[model samples]
Target chain A: MALIELRGVSKIYHLGGEEIRALDNVDLDINPGEFISIIGPSGSGKSTLMHILGCLDSPSKGSIKLDGMEIGSASARELARIRNQKIGFVFQFFNLLPKLNVLQNVELPMVYAGCSSRERRERAMDALRLVEMDNRAKHRPMQLSGGQQQRAAIARALVNSPKIVFADEPTGNLDSHTGETILKLFHDLSLKGSTIALVTHDPEIAAVTPRKIEIRDGKISKNVDAKLSGQHDGPKFAVGSQQN
Target chain B: MSLLNAILVGLREIWAHKFRSLLTMLGIILGVSSLIAMSAIVKGMEHGMKEAMIALGGLDKVLTREAPVPTWQSHLSDQARGRTMRDVEALQRSAPLIRMVSPEMALERVTISRGDKRTRPSEFVGVWPVVIEMNLHNLEHGRFFNDVDEANAHAVIVIGTAIRDDLFGSPEQLGREVIPIGERVQINGQTFTIVGMFEHYESDQDRKKREWAREHPDEAAQKQAVARGRPGYGGGGSRSGWAFDRKNRTVYCPMNTMWLRFRAASGTGNVPDPTLTDIDFKVEDLSQMEDALQQAKNVLLTTHNGIEDFSFSTQEGNIESVDQAIRNARMSGGIISAISLLVGGIGIMNIMLASITERVREIGIRKAIGATFLDVFTQILVEAVVIAIIGGLAGLVAANLLVRFLASLSPTGNTPIVTFEAMAMAFGFSVAIGVLAGLFPAFKAAKLNPIQALRYE
Candidate 1:
């Protein structure tokens, strides 16, 4: 059975007296250790789909089952528990708490999970080390470069040991070199059997991932083949190589 | 997360916005300090008033004096006279609630001496042994005259604070047991032994005298020398109308002792040896003062053949008027200060609301990371309370210092009594205000939609 299953999920939004279908009868399934990219234009409702899939927002209709538990109708607390223990999210804005140093930001999830201080500190350090951010552990988000900030944010997402990771334009604010480094980090985690979902508006960004799901006008345009051929083009690239 | 972590976060947030936090706490600080200061001032006022009452004997005492003759009368009649010893005897017989009636007599400008240490001529009081108890003069050392001393016409006296300093050379001697009982002194060329000393009851006049003495020690010494050279120059200044003030410089001897040694031996023509001034009446119980006063007045009028010559003054009535004034003062002060506390609580509420608005995204992020609504609510509530408590504790410290400084400046040198209950009350008020003020803001923060909040700019 798939690790995550979405059945006929539909979402409608009312904005200024106009009915807009943000997600129309979307059905999808994600297997364990799958590295998938969701691609769409600006108004394609890809972010809304990611929000629903991550359980940050509930689906307006249809059932979502993760690990055999239906989540579409779950209570707020249950959704919060699923977010904390099962899924990790990295946003376009990084979303690191600015007042916190890198290490404390990474420790935030375990803090809500009620982990002991010693264990939290150890796990946070290990996560930062994995993202090559342990040296900047004491630096606040504002003190870091854009790439370093995203690295710290990724460290935070991975620190909880979630079953799946979601990146919504994780490289949107970074230089191409830094963006490739972050993508390579995601690839390494996926290769290590961690389920990954990468959301982007650029087809080239989606081309690097093993699988791609394309969205258009609030509906799924394509559920591509299991593997996109010739996408593992090494973790590093020459500077300024990729563009819109 | 545990409550401790939440508290630490709150504290850190406060510290991050130091000026804003201080401004938020200002209202609470002012409210708490004013409350404490007002209580202290009221307490000091009560202490001063109570001491004054004690000096006037007590609420159960009454003073009866001869009333002036009717102003409508055109002709002067020699038959109408002031109260006499006979009237005192009549009251003693007529009023069962009257415990004792003591007579007050004064010998103006009499020299008092002990070896070389003599007070310049001051008033000399002649009173019965019961006069000491009736007047409520606190004895600092030795003892009051007893029936044995009065009966024997013993040359024994209890000096007042002023005279104690004058004759003994130091007021500190009174408290140190330096002036032993049976120590000899002389009053009006007659020898007397010091039997007791009166504790100094402070008044505005007393404070002035002390301040004067402190500023002009040499001048005071020269004046004492000049008064010593002349016999009648330094008596309890006849201008000091208080009987206690006069007594301070005057010598107190048993009424019989004054009659036997000075009145009988001297050639000065005056009323009979046992002639009286105003008589002091002590009721058996405080509640019986009104009845006691009326009965004594009736007896005095009857004894004088219905002349209605004497007027009565009850300590109970005097104290009630004074107490009413104190209560009025306290109520006004309390109301004004309580308003300050209310303003402080409102300030807390305002600041908490602003904080919720400023941290909307933070709240969303925490919720996104699995913080329950209850968790977010408690966190904000903790932040508000911490601010209140900090402000309250600061107010307490400031109030205490202010109270001490004000007491030091006061003539009576009385400070506010900082009761444990008052501290706890002030602290508890701040905490309650924290919770109340934080409630709406915390609720608003907790109810924010995670998706909307994360998207908030």
Candidate 2:
């Protein structure tokens, strides 16, 4: 079954008395274990789509189903519960709480999920090891490099064992090398059967995900697989294998 | 998130900005302290005045006098109004709670002289000896006047210690016969002789007694000295020792003697002269003082034909009133002192509010991590209450130290004390201030939107 499904979802914003359309009639389905990417220009609505799919924002129109639950009609409390239980978020800026060390950031989702402290610690360590960041668990985000911060953010998302992890411009603020490494981390997670939705303007990131969708002027313009685009440079590199 | 976790985070945020927290709580602290201070001052006043009144005389006695409706407003009349020799007799006859009661005659500006010894201006009041004895006479020499003196319109006198100094300069004046200025003693045309001397006394023994006497010169403290039997002096000027040449001073004399000699009026064509102004009677039993006073009230009420003009002022209540007056005087002062505490409470409140503003994201994070709004609200509220309680306790300790310092300044060696109520009230006010001030900010924290909060910088 699809973990996330949207049908004719649209969002409009009122800014200074002028209507701004952020999304329009977007329909998509993301199955569990699939690695997907949505690519577009800055104002093309991909980020807004990520926000809705992650349950951070609700659809203004149309029905949204997360793992077959009608999330569009969910109350604020229900949305919070869904956010804590199902979706993990990664921002380009890493979004690691500055006051928390790496392990705490990773363990945060489990803490919110009502897991025992011991259980939270155990799951956090597993996620950290999965992202190859177990050794830097005690360090604050400021002490980690761009690539490590993104890895930590990814670890935090996975600690709750959510059905899908959403990354917004995951490498927008990182160097090319760091960006490529972070994309490989997405590839690695996908190999381990973790579903991911990567939102970015970079074709390189879109190339890393097996399935790609393009957004233009607040609407989905195309659905193109990486093989269909004939972009194979990303998989050839094993970019996340820097530890090897 | 658990309450423990929320509190931990709230405290961490507060600790992170210590100075801001202190500043915010300033207002709460001051408001609490001011309330406590006013309470304390009132307590002190009550205590001080009670002591003063108790020392004046026991609360048991009542003063009675003959006063017809004067041209002035009767409402402003002294408590002694409506009491006459007849009222004293009626009270002495019918009150079941009767302790002994005595009557006094007032003589004004009477004079006396003997040979070359002319007495200075003074008072001459005829008094019964047993009534004087009711007041535990701490005589410097001779005893208070006896009933025999009242019967004979005694040439004998009981003088204050001050009189000894003016007449003979020592206790040796006990037996000396000083000439009254009137050749005997005169007040509206009557005369008497001085036969005995006693000790001088300043009415108030409180620390401010001398100062009050100094300031109010014409009252009880600042008056001229005189001899009882001097040719021109009146019966030794009551308690104040005023000067007179049978003319300017009012004196104290036995009511019995005064009634017989000068106060009696005939209902003929001749108009009667008003001679006796008032009478202060002492009671024997201190415990029965009120009962005696009530009895006197009932008897006098009827004797005067329901004249409510007479008032019975209790010595205890008088002293209590003084205490009340003192406390009332210090009400504003106490508030001023506690103003600092209010500033401190506000300091704490300010700190908490600033902290709420700074940790918006943390609150968002906690909520996102499963913290209930209740958890967040309680966390902030507890922090504020804690600051207030601590500050309030500190103020209480300071107040005690201040009271002790004031106590050291008291003449009786009694300390100005702080009651438990004051202590509790101070702390209670502090906490109240904290809660009241913290309520709005804590509510804001509880209502924060997790998504928007997470997005906050």
Model 2 misplaced regions, further than 4 Å: A73-78, A100-163, A170-195, A206-208, A224-244, B1-4, B26-42, B57-61, B64-157, B169-200, B203-357, B360-390, B397-417, B439-457
> Against the unseen true structure, what C-alpha lDDT does each candidate score?
0.81, 0.67
Q: Write the per-residue lDDT of candidate 1 for residues B1-457, one digit (tens) a residue.
A: 7888889889998999999999989898988888888887877777777776766567677888767766653143345666766877887888898988888766767787777776663457788777768876678888888889889988888877677676665643343545546777777676788888777655566467666866888887777677676655233333333655555554678877877787666544754544466688788887776777777867876776666656887766667887898889778987887788888888988898988898888888888777878888999999999999999999899889878888778745555676666677877887888888889988999889988998898
DockQ of structure 1:
0.49
Give the alpha carbon lDDT tens digit for every residue of B162-201 in model 2.
Answer: 3333434333335364332222433344445444444344
Looking at model 1, residue B432 earns an lDDT score of 87
Position A82, candidate 2: lDDT: 84
Cα TM-score per model: 0.71, 0.68
Report lDDT (Cα) of residue A22, candidate 2.
Answer: 92
lDDT of 1 by residue, A132-159 (tens): 9999999999999999999898888888
- How far does residue B38 in candidate 1 sit from its true spot (Å)? 1.6
- B200 in model 1: Cα distance from truth in Å? 11
